[model samples]
Target: DTFTEDQICQVQEIHVGKPRIVATIVPKGSPFKKMMIYG
Candidate 1:
């Protein structure tokens, strides 16, 4: 639930030219979908 909110805020910040950075946290060796990710 909170993760979704964080992504939304990160995206909005990026759109507004904010210096905040957003990074994804995944388990080591985990495989992610071959698409753009906001989380």
Candidate 2:
């Protein structure tokens, strides 16, 4: 995966009502500045 273990953990913590949605985490200027999650 593009995300690290900690980054993955951060994504897992997020909760939403929709089954399919996009998630963007981390700050700008970093390698993983933008992340897209869809499942």
Candidate 3:
């Protein structure tokens, strides 16, 4: 099955409604590693 860009975006809009907390992951040698925090 194949989905167009519009179709994929629509699905994401429904599922990714709200984000409580966001975390940025970086490489081990990078400045910031896997750091998680509350919302």
Candidate 4:
């Protein structure tokens, strides 16, 4: 997926402050997507 420059920059900035902000995918199709935070 292509993200805008600003969006990418924002994500980078967020990573600088908190380097663990990524989504965790679970097995099978579900309605809930888990978000794992590890700083």
Candidate 5:
């Protein structure tokens, strides 16, 4: 999945004074996963 430029910009603005938003996609039984942090 991809985020539009506007969506990304909006998220960036919201992240300015707070901790970044972290997203993870894990399988049903996966213990390890990758995360994407945005600010």
Candidate 6:
């Protein structure tokens, strides 16, 4: 899904001291779907 750049609220490292990412985000409109994400 394509989301407007303005829709982006925030982007940052999930862990403060770690450099590994196990999950990523897939933007969504619905609150429920929005909760789900993948890289």
Candidate achieving the largest TM-score: 1
In the range 1-39, model 2's lDDT, one tens digit per residue, is 497987877774566566887666667676565333222
For candidate 1, which ten residues in a row score worst on lDDT?
Answer: 30-39
Query: Please, what are the lDDT tens digits per residue for candidate 6 over residues 1-39?
Result: 976776655644355685777765545576656456431
Ten residues in sequence with the least summed lDDT for candidate 2: 30-39
Residue-wise C-alpha lDDT for candidate 5, range 1-39, written one tens digit per residue: 999998877774343585787766767655454332221
Candidate 4: tens digits of C-alpha lDDT, residues 1-39: 899998877774343464666666666554443332322
Candidate 6: deviation at residue 22, Å? 20
As for candidate 2, its clashing pairs are none
Misplaced by over 4 Å in model 5 are 13-39
For residues 1-39, could you state the per-residue lDDT of candidate 1 as single tens digits? 356876777674235565788766766656562333534
* Residue 7, candidate 2: alpha-carbon lDDT: 81
- Give each prediction's root-mean-square deviation over alpha carbons: 14.0, 16.3, 10.4, 12.9, 13.2, 16.7
lDDT of each: 0.57, 0.62, 0.60, 0.56, 0.59, 0.58
Q: Which residue ranges in model 3 land beyond 4 Å of their true spot?
A: 13-39
RMSD over all Cα atoms, model 4: 12.9
State, as a TM-score between 0 and 1, how close model 3 is to the true structure. Answer: 0.28
Q: What tens-digit string does per-residue lDDT give for candidate 3 at 1-39?
A: 999998887774365566678657666665444232222
TM-score, cand. 5 vs. native: 0.29
Off by over 4 Å in 2: 12-39
Question: Candidate 4 — which residues are off by over 4 angstroms?
Answer: 13-39
- When sorted by lDDT, best at the front, the candidate numbers are 2, 3, 5, 6, 1, 4
Q: What's model 3's overall lDDT? A: 0.60
**Residue 31's lDDT in candidate 5:** 43
